[model samples]
Target: MIGDIHGCAKALRSMIQELAPTKEDELIFLGDYVDRGPDSRDVVEQLIDLQSVCKVIPLRGNHEWMLQSVVSRGMDDSMWLRSGGRATVTSYGGSVRKIPEEHMAFFESLLACYQTESEIFVHAMYDPSCEVATQDDELTYWTHLPPSLPAPHHSGKRVFVGHTPQPDGEVLRQSHLVCMDTYCFGGGYLSAMDLETETVLQVDRHGHVRRVPVERFAMLLKGCVHWFRSRDS
Candidate 1:
């Protein structure tokens, strides 16, 4: 699974090359493919092209929701424009109208969440009280993970999400949830994780690559638990 791209095409390109995934690999992107960086246009184009190389599942982020509201529903774009939409417009040659038909279709087709037997993927937080299928848009695409860990989802499947940027370039890992947004557009890394092996690969816009070892569960949980207890006290 991959974290939010946020228009950092350079980092995205670098990470793809580093992964060197084949047709046998399935890539899940936790969206925000546009806005706030140098090349939202190229980022979307690359994602579309990736379909030919692997099975790509893209989720809708709040940024995508905002863009869709403007381009598809013909709503006021002023809010989106102020919130990094201008960068997206500039990436598309200074107008949203220049965004291609195929790209529009891609945006329209993005999923709110995807689930497998043991894992659930969404762009943002999920309601632990509800099933993944029943999650509302606010929970699926807008809400950030709280400072303290949330209750585990009722399904017993691990939940993976992006949207809450980790400025320190670390994956926010807990027993039940993992947040991969490393804030690439803001000079952090673009992060990807291998679920089976628990390996994390991070790439920067300058094409630097790094591998982060997954922390031992006991140690990770111990520290987090301590923090939570202290916060409550």
Candidate 2:
């Protein structure tokens, strides 16, 4: 799974090279593919091209939602424009109209969330009390993870999300949830994780790749304790 890519195309390209993903690997992107950095158009173009190589599931982030509202729905553009949309516009040669039809389709087709047997992937928070299928847009694309950890979801599947930028450029991992937005557009790294191995690969705009270890045991034990206590109570 990959974190938010906020238009850092060089970092995205570097991370993709580092992963060397093939047709066998499924790449899930927690979106924010446009805005706030150089090359938003290139980022979207790269993502569109990636679909031909492997299975790519792209979830919609709040930024995408804002852009859609402005472009497709013809709502006010000022809010989005102020919040990184200007960079996206500039990326498309200083006008949203210049955004290609294919790229617009890519944005419009983004999913709210994706679920597998053991994992749930969303662009942002998932309400623990609700089924993943029924999660609202506010939670799925807008809400940031609370400062305090949320309760485990009823489904018990691990949730992977991006949106809450980790300023320190680290993946925030808990037993049930992981946040991979490493704030790449703001002098941080773009993060990607191997779900099966819990291995993280981060790439910076300068094309630097770093491997980070996930502290699995400690988080797992903590979650186990919480689960047991909750069951007992």
Clashing pairs in 2: none
lDDT of 2 by residue, 19-101 (tens): 88799889999989988989999999989999988899999889999999999999999999999999999999998888889
Each prediction's TM-score versus the true structure = 0.89, 0.89
- Could you say which candidate leads in lDDT? 1
Against the hidden true structure, what lDDT does model 2 obtain? Answer: 0.89
Give the whole-model CA lDDT for all candidates, comma-separated. 0.90, 0.89
Name the runs in model 1 displaced over 4 angstroms.
211-233
RMSD of 2: 7.4
In model 2, the Cα lDDT at residue 229 comes to 100
Candidate 1 residue lDDT tens string, 109-129: 999899999999999898888
| Candidate 2 lDDT trough over 10 residues, lowest sum | 209-218
